[model samples]
Target: MFIGAVPKEVVGQVLATVPFDAWGNVYVGCSGSFRFDRAVKMRHPECRVYSNDVSLLTCSIGALAMGREFPVKFKGALAFVEPAIDGLDFRGRVAAVMVAAAMGNFTGKNEYAQVHFRHYREHFRTFVDQALPKLDALVAEIKIEEFYAGDFLEQADRAENSGGGMACFAPTYKGGYERIYKLVNENVEWPAPKYGIWNPDSLPALIVSLEERHIPYCVISDQLLADRTPTTEWRGSNKPVYTYSSNQAASLRRRLPNEVPFKYTPVEPAAITAESKVSMCVVDSKRMTYLKNVYLTKGIEHTTGQINCLVLIDGALAGGFIFAQTRFGDKTRELYMLSDFAIARERRLSKLIPMIATCREVIQPINRRLLIKVEYIVTTAFTTKPVSMKYRGIFELDKRTADHLQYQSAVRNQSIQDVFHEWLRKYAGQGGKPDRQGQAARAEAAGEECALHDAAGV
Candidate 1:
């Protein structure tokens, strides 16, 4: 331990006892992430999507990593989503946010913060004298509340409150009880937000507290990520100290409007680029409904994307690929059918690969920041209760194997243009076979449908 580093477990127990949290979820503020970086994606496989858009890294390089000459159509954005309600089993769905520099304290207090309070104080009066405390105090209060409402309340309420009973938090010895009491009582407000090199003692306490409350949180500490460099500019009087792409949903706007009327204007987070996508699926007509999910999973399996979407081409695919109607902000997205075909295993061979290769052609490649080779990565698939899970990881596709199918300019001179045109044809033609439930719900929102028709002998 350094001259003044305290045991993290002691502090974690103290904070846990205070019961900080809103519904037992640790809400963390953070700096944005460069791209996919985590165990979740590495361990699961369904997240793979073939993006015909700007790569997350090396944004300027274009889709170079997806080097090819197939008919590539560009998708402005990609998105992956899961049901928010009971998305995973109780123990699996616990969402933990760790705010690091820029979002969480970049000081010793926040275990993941890389800089200390002293380093932060070097900048100005705002951090050390004011902002830091407000931030920390808010965290403390929230942590306590999470315990009361989500942890303890759930314990006394139901068995399904995300492991909210005695088992998650049975017993543990806290050694520095007297010491933590002393630290908590210290009225010594930092001269500035302590900004020396960050210390990691804070996370242990948060983890400890979470155990006590039966709340599950994943650690996303700044000290534990790729982008960690101490700079005063990222910090400010009001902005969070850090930000990450995953936490963007919450961090971008620290506060939201309340149900009650307020005197001041209540602003909302800036709208994100909602994804507009489509997929083509081939299935045995007799089993369409039963095998639809499996077919959809297959498209995701074969594509290289951050998000995947599919359009089923039964006998209905007379034109091309069709895009269902949806509007994102002022931008209207179009869907097209790049190819047309019948339902067969051979179709997967001739159609699926060519279709995927086409999408790969148009997208720019990733080159900057922490670069990772995509060729070796594979998505892991597993199912645990509420939702079938998918994540990303490293795997290999051997080009030297006799099974490897070589392509002609990435699939017989097929270009991104071919892909997009096909997609547009399908999207503009007609919507998918009637979605009874979805139709009933969208009855209120004004919506339009598009379709495409194109056919060739198999």
Candidate 2:
């Protein structure tokens, strides 16, 4: 297995989004395992793929993968390497370095075999039986036209000047690659890296430079750079992978066939339309239990011990929302926080359904149940998207923290029954479902059941 490799599903989605088919030349910077290079070559055989990196081990492996010679001289400094590695040929030497590098201890100052004897032994034992075959297969299919050992920016400049080319950069987010390859460097005496680990702080300037130059490019980053929002985000991985593209690339991508290339596929609920009747009813927290740990990447646990409500669209359980006393500001201020919100997988409903329900319908019931007047309501959303489309028009953007977007709005002064009647009048003569509407109004009038709890198909 390759270290720090992008997930295969993410690679597929990136390929699906990027307009690589139209470009003749593609350059991959910081090509640690050459994963992107291999993917681009596999998809478009006509494109010439170039791989560049500062690590000698990476370049050595690339050379061996292409049946070329290993340029570095070991000078017998690698006596710690196992004898089974067969140091006589390019392929065997490649195997030797790959195994040793995997076994080396990068966290510490020294990486001698004695320091990590057990790891070195284990990797040596499994190199031929497990790792070699994978490498052999990779070499057979990979047809990268050239491999360069130099600064990544030099290669990026080449791609930028090529007139019809694209560049992909997957830089090391954290420092210490130099330490990881210290053992190999000590033996081969490769030159010092002209560039160190990529500083995420430098991303904004680099993005601006690439855009000003009109270079077609993509950058893979660990954290969402909120200064300039990414053109698109792929959620195939556990943590969102943010991809920033140049203006030229963004324009070209928009012209491609697939307009929506996100991972979430739409499966619209049956017989639901813009005219469908919508209602917000109080429900047992257990009714919204299924969505408890799924609203965000961290899970739905954040909304636990908070108030819960469900939204019905066209008399069908569309989704649910949760809120509680504001976790940030003073409790005496009478502010509530909309902690979590989600839609059912089967229903491709508008997000406005939940927003409007939370604001207009649930406010009075929640205020009455809690015995307080909620003068202001706040909500937070986490996304790498340029705009949180759900709250763009309805709520005022209060502030943006590092992790999420915060929005607040004043609670409307209307009664629960008044809001319900207003909704019914708004959707009048739209072939709306009036059956559940009357039931919801009756439940609210009784004060015991403020919401329609038809848990039939939730």
Candidate 3:
């Protein structure tokens, strides 16, 4: 589902621009497939190449491929394949097992399933026959100095402090690692990562974080169009790959490619009717990141204990709300804090959708079913003005701070569906539907360039 494997073309592009001769050590953070690590080791044999990833399974495979001694013994299908895979030492044997497990997990069958089902033995035998030889060859070629399993930020900090080291980060894009590596993670008993994954939408923040902390780094992403930053673009296997560097001099040395700026096209707004609806559902990290980048000023925040929800207006993605458990000491009852709220610029949806979304009556029971008892809902809006227009009608301003305005709202008694229907009825009675002829006349008066206004929300 998630492949960190960098193509040879991109690797060549990276090796050409990065000033590896200046640094004694190179750190590869978020080493998903370790393809870049292998390439770096192959090119710079004299340099100490280290690989670090958040997943234990990824580290295990990386360690074995790079010839590091793995301490853990695997018990299951791999153990049963001792007869098939021969002449492999402890590291090779473990590597073979882990690689096989990862492959099986990628396909619907996990280690447990492969171990239990007799039909799955052929898959293991197939890997032993076809894939193990490649792994053995890679082990012979790659010699990674060390492999680390932890947060990439911590690893990057160490690289910066080391004085003569550089970090290359290919942070996971759009889709987060949680769902992509779910099967392999569960099989390895790896705990959920505490760090945030970066996508094109959240990459600018990541670059700023690295720069502000004075960390020397380069990033490889597929969709990032770096703004005013030193970047080199290359044609990837499927999409264009852009490498962003902290070293402006080195980046400027590379020739720039013919590139096009990214644009977002908003979906046409549907007319409000009795059938027009509002709903909320769980939103994935990928979708949430895109929405945040388009609508919210701060983009995505790397906070723990947060649930992302999608706000739908007539089945279209109108907005999003990120709710987190209160970080403060509140032993009284479970409190839900609204971490971030955003709405589409094109769709003029009511703020009531988000209001009901955060209400205790609406979300409380849903969380209660999962064993969380929520009583109060709280939110903060950061703005220089005395009041935030977004929260004026929906949330009651409870307190105002020097930097932000805090708001609290009471839960409504009616269900969200019932309230939505009533609101629609009232809207229809008020002739809320727009006049198409007037809209067309305004568009003609504004001209073709004005039609591009809807392209802001992507």
Rank candidates, TM-score, best first.
Answer: 2, 3, 1
Question: 1-458, model 2: which lDDT tens digit per residue?
Answer: 34667667667766876777666788777788777888988898888898888776677767776667744444344564545554446666666667666655543555564567556564564664466676677677668888877666556566756744445564545555766776667666434455545555666545533432334676777667643345556787578876665432233322212121111111124445545555655555543443321121111112244566666655544445667777668664455555434332122133444345445346666666667667677765542223455566556788874324677777655543444344444432233233331233233222122345432312
lDDT per residue for candidate 3 within 49-96, as digits (tens), equals 777886655666666765555444434433555555556665555555
lDDT preference between candidates 1 and 2, better one: 2
TM-score of 1: 0.19
lDDT accuracy of residue 388 in candidate 1:
12
Q: Give the TM-score of candidate 3.
A: 0.47
Question: What tens digits encode model 1's per-residue C-alpha lDDT throughout 1-458?
Answer: 01111123322322333222222322321101212111112222322211111111111111222221111111111001012212322111111011112222342455445454334324323332343444333322221112111111123222223322121221122223123223211321211111111133433333322322223333332233222111111222233222112112122222211111111110111110112222333222222211111122111111122212223222122111211121321112222221122222111111332343334332112111113212211111111112111011111221221111111122213343455345344322332233222232233222223222121100
lDDT of model 1 at residue 414? Answer: 37
Best by TM-score: 2
TM-score of each: 0.19, 0.49, 0.47
In order, what is each prediction's RMSD in angstroms?
A: 23.9, 16.6, 18.9
Pairs clashing within candidate 3? none
Query: What local distance difference test score does each model get?
Result: 0.22, 0.55, 0.54
